[model samples]
Target chain A: MDEVRNVIELKDVTKDYGDFKLDRVSFAVPEGTVCGFIGQNGAGKPTTINLILDVISRDAGEITLFGQSVDRNSAALREDVGVVFDEMGFHEFMTGRDINIMMKNIYRNWDEAAFFENLRTFSLPSKKKCGAFSRGMRMKLQIAVALSHHAKLLIMDEPTSGLDPIVRNEMIGIFREFVMEEDHTILLSSHITGDLERIADEVVFINGGRIVLTGNKDEILEKHGILKCKKEDLPGISESLIVSSEVSSFGAQALINDRASAEKLYPGAVIEQAALEEIMIGYVNGKR
Target chain B: MKGLILKDLMCLKKQLTTFVYVMAGTVVISILYVLSTRYGNLARVGEQLLDQNNGMSRVDVKNLGSEAMVLFMFLPIVCVGDLMNVFVADGKAGFYKVSSSLPVPLYKRVLARFLTIYTLFGLGVLVDALLAVLLCSMTDIMSLGQFLGVIFSGASILSIYSALMILYCVLLGYGREQYAQVLALLTMAAAFVIIKFDSVRFFVVHVLGDGVGFDSSVFWKPLDFIREKGYVLLGIAALVSVCSYLLSVRIAERKRGVI
Candidate 1:
């Protein structure tokens, strides 16, 4: 692995919560690339991010952020990494200006002018208390803070979960600009696959606490295809190659991992490109 | 650290206003009671302690001081509320994780909260002392030395109480509404028991009012005993503060995801 080029890397990370276990997982986000962490509600995306942040301890395996072991240099590593949670985590009584002042004290690289400019860009009120802000506004404030600090790496957990389409589109553009700088990178986790498809360079899909797929977004979409065939032709398809299959009175639809191989084997079947959502659903169903 | 302290102080300003109002009310009532009983006509008493049969005699200056101390207990309770407010506010706003995740050490954060609460408590005590002195000057009942002693004693006791409150707030983790109600009930019960039982009265006297010439020697004797034992109590309070801080740090480190 090219460790030098990788900003965040997790190797065989495992966290056990008695009844629920985050199984051995491995993935890496290359420097200057956006890695989309795709998973369902209980797919352990938050758990993995938590482990990487050292917010929660893992049972086994090593995590390296900024080319240093997380445990050995967590405080220093955190200085350069900006994190945004799905929910806004700030005192309701504090205004955006108050937050800027407080955060400036924490991060030596925190720029007040940049923070205020971003707040203006996001159209957030500087003096209004956070409690008065709507959900979209709160998320924008969080992002504004995350970007104002000169953090080299950004880790966001479902930052756009409930945002309106327009705000989501705007945020996606901001994220694109964020990674334009050579040293900056982002690892974004969200259940919304459509946004990931539009922004992510690499896609890592997790299901039931395990990594089901990891590859380039375009490559994964290009290789995986949905085959629509008659019910009688379903038996002709090999179960080993089908990730998942939906049966109906009219026909059977199956998701195949390798379109080229499936096409060679089943010449009569109709194949179409599968969206990221379809691929996620097929992998989560574990039909293969 | 400066920013954290400023934030804490800004959040506490409203509660500080309430404390000032309560202290002012206490001083006004004390002045009214003194005037109604002892010095209704300041011209009548000429080197003689006014005596009355089956009615209020010249109010015992020491007993008056003890009453003043009782009034000041609210200051510490209010200070405790200030400390607890930080936790409750953060918990309500979902900001605990955000603040804890900062590079600043958890101990420093806890210390900042403590300093804010105690500094406010100190200011409350100063206001109470000023009010008491003003009331005493109007009543012509106590000397400057005696007034200063009462203020110093009241502040010392408040410091210990504020420390205990900080420890309690940390242990409870913002789930203190029920605990607070139960504690109020227990305090009322204890007050009733002490008032009704002569033995308990005697114990209170021996502990708080040994040398203080108060009509209710029962209350001041035990307080005097407590004052004598102030170092030990203060030590315990300091130890509790340190332990609670360490426990809070451990909790912060173990927390995963968001709270």
Candidate 2:
């Protein structure tokens, strides 16, 4: 495998907020790859993003973006980075045209033509206030702004959480288009595993502020498997291979961390490839 | 920096009507002060004398001075109000957090806000001085020298007050909103207490109460001190404004949240 360059790197990042602590989390997003940041509510997704953006200071750690320290490059290097929060982060009173004008002044490389083109393509009126926009429309507007700035890295948090299926698909398609340039990267944080499954090249799962899994999507899927066997046989299976399991009167379905070992050990049972959602659920359930 | 300032200006564009209303209110209040002082008939003095048991209808010059004080008093309020409008609008709409994600430096963001508030405050002071000069002349309430003194002294005091108000708004912008309110009340209390002191009250009355024909013997010493050192006071106000701005920028840079 060719060594890929990382565009976003978090090394031993830690943040303490009295009630919760993000304990020494570390991950890297390679260039041109869609890195899905998977976590449940209160799992420190926003906190990490905030630290990267310097919206809040980090307690301890080093974050580098675009080959520069985030602390030192906050102003200069941010020109090549785009960010979209779960909320639109725009004044509801502003129209799309207003935002375009504002962005033109804000980003030196802001492509006015591209922004307008996006508005037209999205069927969003340039003069209409964003307060009147539908949830999908708001998400589209943010995506448009993120793309128009000539950003090398796009960081988005929950960009598709509330969107309808069609809109989410459209957003995914847009992400695919963005990554086609071979230099563009995306750090997309979403709870919707299906969207990540469709588009993400790499996945990083975070639970309780700690990274549980980080690797290529295909490898993770291949390494973990679901083994179905009689309920009585679950206790007899090797505990090391079992991530988590569900036992019922009819049978037992267990998620195995190592598929080859599980297949070798349970010769009579059926083993199926685990989806990303199941893998995440298995880890989460295992913690309990 | 220009972009950040432009964003604030764009946000303030919606407040044009409010600006007009505030100016109109200032004019009405100025006119009332002029009428109450120059045209006491408007206060219904003759009717008050006829209705009351006492036949004497003395014009309450102190009351008129208080009313005139309110006209200048409104300066700080308008200054504070305009600054609040820009910050509150950005905050309530979540654009402040959005700005943190942009390429603009945090210092520039803080500087933009300081510039916006002080720029508007400076403009307000100019308009206010002009209004005072015109109304005082039209009513023949005070001599030209006294009006000049009024302009110099009033502008200096109001500038300091406006700077303090900006500091309060900066606190609010940095999300110490509860502290902002406390600071505002405390500042107001301190201002009133300071004003009640003989020296400060004498200076205030010498400038603002010139039209009321105040007997200067009681405050002659402080009044003379202010006249000689008036320019120094202006310098002090300028110094305070600059220091407050620097402090605000420092606080804003270290702020942890958007609001």
Candidate 3:
């Protein structure tokens, strides 16, 4: 494999909010890779995004994007980056045309033709008020704006959260297309593990503002498994082999970190490949 | 900066449109009122001069001159109101959070806001001056000097008002609606209390109260004070305005994290 350049790198980034702290969190997103930033509600995904955008100040640590410090490069680099929040960040009265005009003034690289093309492709009316847009349409509009500026990176927070599966699949397809250039990247924060499972090249799981897992998606999936065994065998299974387990009246099912090792230790147990959702759940449950 | 101002203008489009129509209507009404009543006032003045023995030489035309001064005072208020509305609109749309991700610098954003308010206020002053001239010409109540003095005094006071309002908004931080409301109430109460002070009373009365409009004896005092200390006062106002702007930018920079 060719050595990949990191588009985003955070080393010991910390932000203290008195009540909640992003405790020395660290991760990196390589160029051209779709990094899935997985976290539960209030788990600091938004905080991390905000910090990267220089919207919020961090207490300690370094965050470099596009090979430069955010503090110095935020303004210049923003021309090449696109951001979409969970909520549409435009005023209610503005139309798609109004946004285009405003963005034309804001971004030097803004492409009016691309924006209009996106509007046509997304079936959005240019004259209608965005306040009246459906959730799916709003997300599409944000995507259009994000893509129109010739952005090298797309930082999306819950971009597919409330969309229907059809819309989500379409959005995912669009993202796949965006990354085909091999220089474009995306840092998508979402709760939908299934979406990440399909599109993510790298997965970074954050729980309580701490990174629990960060690795290539396939390898992370390959290393974890769910072991089903009789209740009597649960006590015999070593604690080191079990990540987390659920015990029921009939039997026990435990998530194991190393499938081969678990298989060697529990010969009678049945082991199954763990999905992203199962792995996340196992890690979260085990952490608690 | 231009983009930020454009966004602010778009946010204020409805309010600004209504204001334009209202000002246009006011201009039409003033023209009609001046045309209709000027001849009547002239006839009354003619009769007064003819019956000069009665010792009532001139009836106070009391025309729209005072009303024009009132309008000048209201201009700064409108500017302040519009400025606040822009903040509120931005808050509602979460524009600050969104803007941070944009390529514009923080100071540029703040400068854009200040420039918008100042531009509107400048336009307001010009319109008020034109209206004052028209009203004075039709009524012959106030001399040109007196009209200019009233407008100048009103603008001076209102400039200070606007600067303080901007400072309040900046220091209070963005989207703090409840705190802003409380501060407004406190400011109103403070205004009422401060008026009791001798210096403040002199200043307020000269600029806004009966001293300028109704009391002829103290009428020229404001004009005289302005003539003697006009440059100094304007200098002070400019200095304060600059300080207020710089402080506002600093506050905005510090609070951007919270926003």
- The candidate maximizing DockQ is 3
Q: Candidate 1 on B1-259: residue-level lDDT in tens?
A: 6667777665665676776677666666767656654555432442133353433344444444445444544443454344556656666776655754555555566677667766775676566567666766765555544555555555554554454555545555566734644453454457448656886665568545694433455555655544344455446546655665566555545553222
**Candidate 1 C-alpha lDDT tens digits along A44-88:** 998898788777789999999978998846756788888888889
> Could you report the DockQ of all the candidates, in the order they appear?
0.42, 0.60, 0.67
* Residues A236-255 of candidate 2: C-alpha lDDT, one tens digit per residue: 99999999999888999999
- Summing lDDT over every window of 10 consecutive residues in candidate 1 chain B, give the lowest-scoring window: B41-50
When summed lDDT is taken over every stretch of 10 residues in candidate 1 chain A, the lowest stretch is A72-81
lDDT score for residue B56 of model 1: 32
Q: Which of candidates 1 and 3 reaches a greater DockQ? A: 3
DockQ of 3: 0.67
lDDT, model 1, position B221: 60
Per-prediction TM-score to the true structure, in the order listed: 0.83, 0.83, 0.87
Task: Please report, as a residue range, the 10-residue window in candidate 2 chain A with the lowest summed lDDT.
Answer: A66-75
lDDT of 2: 0.77
> Using TM-score as the measure, what is the rank order of every candidate, best first?
3, 2, 1
Better of 2 and 3 by TM-score: 3
Model 2, span B1-259: residue lDDT tens: 6666676777777565567667777778777766865566644654565468652324333333433544453453354334555666776777766888889887677667667655665665666667666776666544445444544555566566656766776666644555665675578568657756775565567646783535434434434334345676678778877887787777766764543
